[model samples]
Target: MTTLFISDLHLSPNTQDITACFVQFMRNEAIHADALYVLGDLFEFWIGDEDRSEFALLIKNEFKTLVASGVPCFFTQGNRDFLVGQRFAKYTGVQLLGDETVIDIYGRKAVVLHGDTLCTQDTQYLEFRAKVHQPWLQWVFNKIPMFIKKKIVAKVQSGIRDEKEMKSLDIMDVTPSEVIRVMEAHQVDLMIHGHTHRPDVHTFEINNHPMTRIVLGDWYQQGSVLVVNDSNYDLQTRPFFNQSI
Candidate 1:
């Protein structure tokens, strides 16, 4: 059996086509996998676990179905969906992972994360991430009514879009030094993550040891999946086609 990984779906009410693609993936591909790991941005934005919108319920049902079929699923919160809490996990039966986690891949150790923290040059985003990840701030934000929270999220997203346009590509991408540091710190040769949206396999040396970094692509144009087993791994992209769901 092969372990599957995906990230940056950014599923939302506006992207019904992408959502359908994801639903099909869950039903057809994920059910047969050994395990599934969703790296981040499962949703465009997750306001709170209390979100019971139709879109949220649809995604939850898909995860529930996948888990019920005997395949284990895991999730790591992305910059957009960091508010996903225990309530969401309970509903979906998906285990939530920490920002940085290490696991055995077939036999070798591999580190998995959402990958935003590796962009050390993006000081603005890093600062914002620090502020938003505060437990006290999240507790207060969660107490707000859903309607108000939605407005706040919209305003924040708008600001983010404007800021992103002003930033350079290099600033937004992960720092090579940071990547080497993280891999060395974790003592892992393989690292998998999604956030940069630049999907490709990167090879280099860390203290004379070979290292591999796999970046998962966003699901804006196509569905991206990484299939891994004992022998090797394949990164694939599935185009969205018009099909009855």
Candidate 2:
């Protein structure tokens, strides 16, 4: 059986190509996998619960179909779309996974993340994360009306754009020290995540043993997927349908 992992689709009303690609991926490539792990950024913005969007309905249909077809789906929140919760999970037939969580992947211990925290250099974003992640704050925010939340989110997105404009690429990317720290803290050499949109499989030494960090690509010019079956793992990238990366 094979398990698949992907993230940073950043799906939105305007991202029709990515959405169409995703729909096909679920219908064909991902439908038969043993499990599908979406590590987050599934939407460019998810302002409210899953039940609110027809887009969610489109996504739910595919995921529910997958569950019915026997492939379980799992999710983790990213900086942009961490508000996904039980309501979305139930509607989509997927389980919401916690940040910095570990699981047995084909009998190997694998630690998964959305990868925003690894960008330790983005101090402002980190601070924002701290505030938004407070349980009390999240509860209060989730209770707000969708229209109000959308207004707030539009502001947040504008702020994010400004940050990207001002920050250097290195500042917005993962810090090597933080990656090592997380791997060591979790005691897992295999760390897989997506967020920075820089995809690669890097090997490094940790405690005198080989360690791997797999960065999943954001779906922009192309889509990437890592397939793991038993003791085998393969990272593949291709031009999206008729486009190039």
Candidate 3:
């Protein structure tokens, strides 16, 4: 069996390029895969069910297409798109996954996550995360009007950018110790995730053997995807139609 993983698309109403690419990906690449896992941030931001934008609906339809094709797909909450819930999942025919989920990918036990919780340094953001992800918060957010939600998204994005600018890159990224801790907790060597938008393979020693952390890149400058088959896993970065080097 083959499995595909992608995340951090940051999809929203205005990001036509990313939307186009994602639609193409689902129609072309995802159709044949045995399974698909969306780590998180598939949308730029999700306000709630009461105010889901047309873009979200479109993407949800795209996902439903994939699901109707008989391939299993799962979605985990990303920081931006954390508002995704049971309603959205049912509409898209996707199985909603928790923060950290362990599954067997082609024979190897792999741990998958959205990866933000591993960023142990951002204490303030962690607190916000806890609050926003609660069931009640989601219910309230969905009750707000679309215009109000858009304004909130703008405000939050501005604050998030400012916060990222103040924090060092190392601080925003996942900590090595945290990764090891999660690995130990999950009892898995191969972990795949996305959050920081840094695409690279991190190799470390575990039990006197080499372990790997595969980070999935966000779909902004280019398209990044990880494909795993029965034999091995491959990370491929593809340039968008008009993207330049």
Candidate 4:
């Protein structure tokens, strides 16, 4: 059996085609996998678990169906969807994992994450990340009216888009030293994550020991999936049409 991994779908009402593609993937492919791991950014931005939007319902239903089929699903909070809470997990049946979690892949240990923490050079973004992740702050935000929360999220997303244009590519990408440090701390030579939107397999050495990092891609224009089995692993992209679902 194969274990499938994906990230950065950024599904939202505006991205119906991509959402349909994700639904099709859940029904056709994920149902047959031994397990599925979502590294994060599963949605454009998650306000809170109280979200009752049609789009959120559709995605949750897909996950519920996949999990009911006996394929375990795991999720890690992403930079965009860190507000995903227990209610979402309960409704979808996906186990929420920590930002960095270790798992066994066909007898080998591999660390999986959303990949934002690896970008240590992006100090400004990191500072923002730290503030938003505070439990007390999140609790306060969640208590506010849903409409106000939506406005805040919209403004933040807009700011992020503008900020990204000004930030250098190197600052946004993961730091090699941080990756090495994380891998060493976890005592795992293999790591899998998504956030930088650059999908590729990286191979390096740590004190002459071999190390590997696999980056998953965003699904803005196409779907990205990583398939792992006993023998090997492959990073693949699936293209879809823009027609109505």
How do the candidates rank by TM-score, highest first?
4, 1, 3, 2
Q: Look at candidate 2 and tell me the lDDT of residue 18.
A: 84
The digit string of per-residue lDDT tens for model 1 on 187-242 reads 99999999999999999987688999999999999999999999999899988987
TM-score of 1: 0.98
Per-candidate TM-scores read 0.98, 0.93, 0.94, 0.98
Residue 7 in candidate 4, Cα distance off native in Å: 0.6
lDDT of 4 by residue, 1-245 (tens): 99999999998998988987898889889999999999999999998999898878888899999999999999999999999989999998999999899999999999999999999999999999999999999999999999999999999999999999999999999999999989999999999999999999999899999999999999988999999999999999988866665
lDDT of 2: 0.86
Cα distance off (Å), candidate 2, residue 164:
0.7
lDDT score at residue 132, model 4, on the 0-100 scale: 97
The positional error of residue 49 in candidate 2, measured at the CA in angstroms, is: 1.0
Q: Which stretches of candidate 3 lie over 4 Å from their true place?
A: 242-245
Name the lDDT value of residue 245 in candidate 3.
12
RMSD of 3: 2.4
Per-residue error at 119 for model 2, in Å?
Answer: 1.4
Per residue, candidate 2 scores C-alpha lDDT tens digits across 136-162 of 998999888888888899999999898
Query: Of 3 and 4, which scores higher on TM-score?
Result: 4
Poorest lDDT segment (10 consecutive residues) of candidate 3: 236-245
| lDDT by residue for model 3 (106-196), tens | 7788789999999998887899899987888777877777788889889999999898889988888898889999998998989999999
